[model samples]
Target: MKTERPRVAIQGIRASFHEEAALRYFGENIETVECNSFKQTFEALQNKEADYVVMAIENSIAGSILPNYSLMMSYSFPVVGEVYVPIQLHLMALPGVRFDDVKYVTSHPIAIRQCIDFFDEYPRLQIVESNDTAACAKRIRDEQLTDTVAIANALAAQLYGLDVLERRIESNKLNFTRFLILTTHENARKKTGANKASLCFQVNNEVGALAKVLNIFAHENVNMSKIQSMPVLGKRNEYNFYVDIEWGETRQFDNAIKQILKYTHNFNILGEYLKYEEDTQAPKPAPSPESTKRYITVRKIE
Candidate 1:
């Protein structure tokens, strides 16, 4: 009997970076349940429409997505895994559309911002912001807009049958977005190599309260990889701290958690899973001849 493919919920349509991260984590055999917003992704998982959720938590260029942190606290789902996708923005349009023929360029606001240096030189092109990078590419293809181009990924160009006008056009080549793989508590199982964990807690307002919790982790030799503070809703001067920690030994992590429970108010372990290491090297440009043709013909705007 054939095995059933895992269904993953991601915040965007097909061929999006969210989908890219999902594929990287779960592989291409999984089915993608597209969602319009991050909250919707969680809802899908909550409603049993998806087996897992791939949600972007932070970006190297734009920093942490604060709203997602609130969502995590709201739903209280377990983050079972993680994947890092390099933010490689490409310019793509209908087949046979020349570089000089492009009049308008569109993409997600964040994607557009990353490619500002490239667009700064071309004052003739109008910049339009959309909700998803892949959605922009799909619109250009579905509408057959010859004069318009989209700033998206190579996957979008391939999926929509659009030709890549320019590859790796984003201003920052080193940019990357970290996505978390989340599932319902019942479906979450500890992986064999689980060495990292995500935790959130509330500490007393008194001075040294937060420091004491940190000292426990330090005392147990658990390395705190990341710490983010989010304001408790409708509660002034109160904050929830989200922390990611890695450990060399499971006993150290267990001991740290035991000690932290004494100092924290609403301590919650979001998940315990393998940590993903980001690739520092920039992605190579697309090797297609058509993708590189614009480099020789288009004059630098400056």
Candidate 2:
């Protein structure tokens, strides 16, 4: 019997970075359930409409998406895995459209922010923020807007049949977005070879309370990769600490958790999964001469 493909939910339409992350984690065989917002993706998982969810947790250029942390706490889904996608924004338009013909540029707000340096050079072009980068590209194709262009990924250009007019337009070439693979508790199983975990807890406002918890992990030889503090709702001067930790042995993590519980309240183990590591030493190609020239000329447009 043939196995049914997993239905994955993502916070954007097809050809989006969310969909790209899902494909990276689950392969191309999964079905994508598009959601207009991040909350909607969790709702899909909550309603059993999707077997899994791929959500962007952080971006190299934009920093942490704070709202996602709250969503993770609210829904309490298990993060089964993670994937980091290199973000490469391109300016695309309808076929036969020239660069000079572009009057308005549009994309997701985050995508627009990433390309601010490129847009700063051309003040004559109106910048508009839309819901999704791929959606903007689709609109350009569906409406046949010759005077408008969308700042999105190459995948969007390819899927929407739009021609890329400018490549790698993002200000930072090293941009990357980290996405988390989440699922309901019933479907979540500890990943094989798991070495990292995400946890959240609250400690007393007293001095040394927070440090005491960190010290426990340190003494256990657990490597704390990241720590973030979020304001506890309706509470004064109290915060919830979210941490990501890694270890070589599972006992180290278990022992650390046991010790920290004494100093923490409402502690929750969000998930444990294999950590994703990118090859940072890989050489990146320099921008093409044509692209450099386009940047210089576009700067003089105004």
Candidate 3:
């Protein structure tokens, strides 16, 4: 008898970016448990419906998914690994459907927003928001709607037997999304040689309290890759800090964490996992903010 394959929960239907990221991390052999929302994805893991979940934490064009941070705090699932998948948006429709036949396009709102440039040329096309990009494509195929199309990935086009109406329609060609692999705390043991960690903490309302915590990491030579502050509810002028750090020396990172505890309240080490460094899918360096300002202005005029 064969053992069951690992069930990986994802936040969208098959061929969505979540599924693509799941396959990148778990290989093609894993079973997928499709969830309607990120909350549902975590619930699937909590209910033991899935062995692991692949969730997008951030995207190059859309910044961070803030609600996911709140969910992580509530569920306290350990992040075991991560994957960075390149994002490529394509406009696809039913087989043999002509571009002129597409009166409306549907997809996740973010997908629509990313392809703003392409849509500008077709001012008459009605854009509709849906829960998932691939789900919209599936809807088009299942409904046999020749007048509708979905802005999704190449995988969605192949999965639904749709023809690509427009390729690489997104305004940004160097888009990528970072996904986190989450599992129950019992199964979230960090692998040996882990070089990165995620931490969350609240600091005492005092002068230099936040800076003192940063100073410790600096002293230990820990590289702070990302830090975000979320407002604490029911409290005025107070916030919770979420931080990601990378370190070259394990001792230095460990020592910084020990020192940081003394200066913080409700300190929690979310997880420590291997940093994603897949060069093949890695993004090109982004343009500077000053250089991008001109492009943003041009987009508004267009």
Superposition TM-score, candidate 1 onto the true structure: 0.90
Task: Compute the lDDT for candidate 2.
Answer: 0.84
lDDT by residue for model 3 (194-239), tens = 8999999999888999999999999999999999999988999899
Location of the lowest summed lDDT over 10 successive residues in candidate 3 = 293-302
For model 1, residues 171-230, the per-residue Cα lDDT tens digits are 989998999999988888999978999999999999999999999999999999999999
Cα-based lDDT at residue 157, candidate 1: 88
Model 3 residue 246 CA deviation (Å) reads: 0.3
- The superposed Cα distance between candidate 1 and the true structure at residue 124, in angstroms, equals 0.9
Cα lDDT of candidate 3 equals 0.84
Q: Identify the candidate with maximal lDDT.
A: 1
Evaluate all candidate structures by whole-model CA lDDT and list the values in order. Answer: 0.85, 0.84, 0.84
Cα error, candidate 1, residue 178 (Å): 0.4
Clashing pairs in 2: none
List pairs with backbone clashes in candidate 3. none
